[model samples]
Target: MKVVVGIPSFNNAETISHVAKVAAKGIMEFFDGDGMIVNSDGGSSDGTRERFMETDTFGVPKESFVYEGIPGKGSAMKAIMEFSLEQGAQTVVFLDSDLRSVKPWWVERLAGPILRGEADYVTPFYLRHRFDGTITNNVCFPMTSALYGKKVRQPIGGDFGVGKKLLEIYLEKPEETWKTDVARFGIDIWMTTTAINESGRILQAALGTKIHDVKDPGKHLKGMFLQVVGTLFELMVTYQNRWMSVWNIEDVPIYGETPEEEIPPMTIDVDNLKKLAKETLVVPEYVNESAVREVKEDGTLSLNSWVDLLYRSAVQYRKTRDKTVVENLLPFYFARTARFAEEVKSLSDEEAERYVYEQLGVFLERKRLLKEEWEVEDKG
Candidate 1:
């Protein structure tokens, strides 16, 4: 089967060359058939395109293009999709251009299942610092498992592989009101949710460890959290019928290497988040000052409180379609996260992951409230 490794990039010049060359080696080493590496750029002012083009591709048909779609990661991916179709590529593996710890073996692990016809989609499984992906640990993984009834740990993890059928499905999706959902950070979760709700043979590849751009959760999370969560709520509407009946999570087979050593202990500055929480507690339309203080002081919220703050905000975003309302949810998120950090500060990483599942049960118990709020009563 023809294979292509696609890297979506923007202002990633510093690391794109290394990622490109390693990915090139990955394709050349793993795929016995025809293969190439394609860099789909989003008009990076940093000259990422030039750097990628200048990199060696071992005589492979590598090409770089400025994407013409929504001008974000998803559009860059769309460019690769178009190219894959044009070249009659049967399989495509996508890697983030900003990845610093990407290894050649990752390509073999991600693409192997697809090439063998064992799966239509492959998601990455990696060793990440406990605090590294707080969003996933707090929201995506648990929420996805409870709602979709399937366990895929890193739904928005950047690297993955897909076959022609799944590629065609993603290409056929129309992004109108929720363009941002399909545009930037929303793209990853959108892709994973699509694979789950729609029919696909999915696999997870254990790609050792991930070491890339790390950002502080309280500061760097607002924009990404808004986009990813907003897109998640939008998809909830689209796939309501499918997940409504999914109560049991189906297991998917995993391939490649799993981490051997214990990842080091990771921690976050809860005091900083607490201070931030105090500032934003009463800021806007959604947050209640009293409630914020109540949740913050105790470093935890009751199940009712959690549902009221998060699920209600999700419902509001879905109904009003106001980006501001989503932004307003930031303070509450800050407060809740601070509380979560305080509660989990003493636990080991494995214990912490399990503790998060208890939080998921609370979400599952309250999901009906969300369904009630999400549905509109029709008048005759």
Candidate 2:
């Protein structure tokens, strides 16, 4: 097979069929039926696999099976990659099963660059609501850009296109790596960072607006937050040498035009979010006491303090490898997110996006602080 489109799913019966159909259409129409669609399920009882199997691929080959190993998206992806490798596929495009707005052209957009030998890895860039992807907008995007010297707008965006070489390297990761958060929600950032650090040719595919099952950071993201942020901090320590030597940010090449459309409005309970932030009263020793006091008094975390807290926690994690170092940052994350929601509540989507980048500038400006703290801890 020349191309393989893999969908990693759980209980997505409500939406997998649509994703499968478009994936098949994209593969057949763009790749000339030389592609296959595979669904690596997590044993969903919701008939997600059945729905996927039932979809007609217009003569394109398809298969659905429960993947083996710990039940997580990473394991599902590994199964797909292993299968793709066995089949001698050159390009693999992985799509989330719960996506609602994926188009047939998305397959071409993601896999086309790789097929043409222009890029080795593809990351999706979408026009999303101001409140959508709080973790990406607040943490992953900024940190990845600053540390890695490349401005990849969505480091943890779920959809991606992987070339064969990167796929092999990903599968070649040590056995224990998959057992950690990388097996769960941490997978996306792990793949993106690996591509950057490995010196692969990376580019962003402008997939327009990504309408997926959106989650509010305040209402439903504690587990995901911990896993992804923990993985990110761990990666920082692992790639300390690479990031320390990198200084300027370079723009990544884009594959398509930016789309203009109205983003769906997301609802967030700001008062309840502030309540959750307040509940995180036991601050970690590494976090500055004055920052805690300021959040307590103002019910918001400033960008400067947020950066300070993150660097301190990263230094502490490097020294101790204590997982709670990530846990302790949760409340402050909540506070920072709450502040972000309130600040962007009334702004237009364009303005909100600019604000997000402006926040990114803060992280970039304070890169020196993280390096200094990390070096101090290493010497001690």
Candidate 3:
């Protein structure tokens, strides 16, 4: 096949059909009915696979099946990668099943760069609500830009396009790799970081506004937070040689025209978030004592203190590789997120977007400090 579009799904029955239909239309309309759609399901009891198989595809070939290995987006993606490679596909596009804002052009937007041989990997760039992706806004985007020197706005945006070469690299990863956080929410970041360090070319696809099933950070994202952040810290240790020398950030090429959409307001329970942060914060031994004390007194971690905690914790993680290091950082993350919620609550989406970039600038400025700490550990 020339192209294979993969949708990794689990219990997404309500939205899978629509996503699959749109994907099929994109494939047929753009690829002249030359592409295939594969639904890699995680054995959903909610009949998600059945719903996907039932979607009308405008003559595009589609199949849905339960994937093997542990039940996670990563495992399902592994299965999809295997299938896409088996079909001799040249370009592979993966879309999350829960997307409500996906359009037919999304398929082309994601896969076009790879098919045109212009890039090896394509990450999505979307205009999301300020509060929608707190993790991305506060941590992943900035940290990725600072450490890896690529301004990939959405490293874990979940929807992406990969060429055959990149797919082969993913499949080549050892089996033990999947048994960790990569088997869960860590998959997106793992793929992105791998591309960043290993691939020759990477870029972004401007997909306009992404209106997915948004989760409030205070309530719905704890487990996901642990997994994604843990995986990121692990990658930082693993790729120290790659990022330690990256002193300047470079812009990644963007593929499509970015569209403007009126973002819908997302409600966040700030008081509850504050409560959670205050209640859960138990400053680990590795963190700066004074910063923890300030956080306790102020009821929130200021950006500078949060950076100190992260930098110190990352160095400690390098020393011990303990999961607890990442676990202990969670409360601080909650505190930082709560602070962010209050900071951006009154700003327009565009203004809030600029605020996020400004935060990225802080991370960029502090890169020297992180490098100094990491170098000290190396010499010690």
Candidate 4:
């Protein structure tokens, strides 16, 4: 196979060289040094471009390292995909620039299924640290399964391998369809979902170890939620008739059969966590005011608000699978709570907690009921 590895990077100068080296080693093992490394950068102000230009670090040929002019992760991937096709690459694997534990074997493991023709797409399964985002496990995976009838455990996993045919399909599609905010976080989900919808077999390979540095979940909560949920909602609306047919087919597999292994918990800085929480919880006064007014006026929110809620929910969904949009809306939720608190100034602390939780519960219940009805109609 004419394999090519594409690393989509942004300000990852410190880690990019190491990833390049490791990937180089892997490609060298399988192919006779024919493998190439394509770095699709989002105009890194950091020395990421310079680092890649320094040929001593990665033993691969210098001609293989190409920089793209685009700005988003999706754009970066698109650039690499186009370059790979022009280079006559038959198979391509994408690796994130920030991986910490990427071994040479990781590449082979990810691409194994595709080479075997057992699957068209390969996603990574890893032993994640406590603080890692679980949105893939909870929301992205299950929802994908329920909607598309394919059970890919880590639909949004950062690392993936795909064949040339799939790459061509992705490229031929309208750029606007795959190159938006959802594309930023939803690329993997979108890819896996599309592959499944097209009857392309999907597989998950064990990485044996976590690969990337963990970031503050709170900092990413809103963005992740918006990206994931926005992609899903868009899929729901745009492909309503298709997903409606597959909604209750129930062939998607659930994870948890893999044996659990002991791994050290990655420590999260308390100060950082607190800071992230405070920032995330502060709910921009404008977002709250506008969202509330919009909801009250139309009894429905705009696509943007729904996008924001999805992003926030993705963060919470990672922490707890049961989390829904209503559960993740706590930050914006205070707007209504403040009004209720003002109306009943004498309520005790316990009473206030109960009242807010109850209100949230009621809102979520109503949403669930409506969603259930929608699903029923869809399935019908």
- Please list the C-alpha lDDT of all candidates, in the order they appear: 0.78, 0.89, 0.88, 0.60
Off by over 4 Å in 4: 55-59, 62-70, 247-262, 267-372, 375-380
Cα deviation in Å at residue 139, candidate 1?
A: 1.6
Q: What lDDT is reached at residue 117 by model 4?
A: 74
lDDT of 1: 0.78
TM-score, ranked from best to worst: 2, 3, 1, 4
**Model 4 CA lDDT for position 213:** 63
Per-residue lDDT of 1-380 in model 4, one digit per residue for the tens? 36788888889999988888888888888666667888888777888878976745346663334344334677678778888899888778898989877877677766656666766677776665433443553346546655565655567877888887788888887867754653476577777777776645667777755657665443445566556656665565555556656534343322223335454454334344333333335333223356655444433333334334444343334334443443335433222222332433466433543343233223232334334545554466
Worst 10 residues of 3 by lDDT: 291-300
TM-score of model 3 relative to the true fold?
0.98
What lDDT tens digits, residue by residue, belong to model 1 across residues 323-367? 777677666666667767777677776787777666667767777
Residue 132 in model 3: shift from native, Å? 0.8
Worst 10 residues of 4 by lDDT: 332-341
1 or 2: which has the higher lDDT? 2
Off by over 4 Å in 3: none
What shift in Å separates residue 159 of candidate 4 from its native position after superposition? 0.2
- What does candidate 3 score in Cα RMSD to the true structure? 1.1
Q: What's the true lDDT of residue 347 in model 3?
A: 95
